[model samples]
Target: MHRRHFLLGGAAVMLLPVPAVADAAPRATLYKNPQCSCCEGYADYLRRNGFAVEVKPTNDLAEISRKAGVPEDLEGCHTTFIGRYVIDGHVPIDVVRKLLAEKPAIAGITLPGMPAGSPGMVGDKTEKFVIYAVTKDGKAPSVYATV
Candidate 1:
């Protein structure tokens, strides 16, 4: 209860090692074509934003995206699965966090193609990103959010 003891205790606590939270960061598995370096950048971006991303390079990305319900023409460069949802392409971190928070009744969200200035892609952003939501029931994707 003394001032000196309180100050010392606070300083000691601050110096103690902080433990990593168990599963605090959401775990996501990202699948990309073996030759794309942008995918690695995207994975690193995700990791910096509190997502534990595991990058898996595969030649069957097209097949994986198709099986995950992403249309062939609408597939992104990389396919990431987080919990029950699939996030395709270089989607913004805020949008991904929003998708995970909202937990909508859809297969996942996608930012089709490798848009310039997307999360990991280089070049100036030419236009606003239009993210789409795809479902498992073979329905057309709808606009989820525009960022």
Candidate 2:
């Protein structure tokens, strides 16, 4: 092939978008009660960040978490399933994207309660918090990310 043609082809290849690229977002299934405004807001946040969200509204949150293998201590207002990873509470989209991209061996990521500074729970000021990776056996979770 001519050098000019080859260079043009290479540039075109570089500009092509790959579906499996780390920046590509995975779909998530979010479970929450129908009347929960904050939970809806969180879902919107995920949608805005390119997450394909499947929202299941129900009042039986405990059952949902229990079936999903979410630990009691790591419980949050909204529970989400992104592939094999469970995302609890109002986790940041970036962090969730990172978790999916990395595909860690842990059961999931949890923000615990509805923290004032969490993505959907944004209050007066942003507070630093840690999202934990809950092990399968439900032990003390390791830190997944700090926000």
Identify the candidate with maximal lDDT.
1
lDDT string for model 2 (4-110, tens) is: 99999999999997777433666789999888889988998888888878899988887877666667777888999988888888888788888888998888888
Cα lDDT for residue 33, model 2?
Answer: 81
Model 1 / residue 47 / CA error / Å: 0.6
* 14-40 per-residue lDDT for model 1 (tens digits): 999886884688899999999999999
**What TM-score should be assigned to candidate 2?**
0.76
TM-score for each candidate, following the candidate numbering: 0.85, 0.76
Each model's number of backbone clashes?
A: 0, 0
Q: List the residue pairs that clash in candidate 1.
A: none
Which residue runs of candidate 2 sit more than 4 Å off their true CA positions? 1-25
Reference-based TM-score, model 1: 0.85
Superposed by TM-score, candidate 1 places the C-alpha of residue 138 at a distance from the truth, in angstroms, of: 0.8
The residue pairs in collision within model 2 are: none
Residue 116 displacement in candidate 2 (angstroms): 1.5
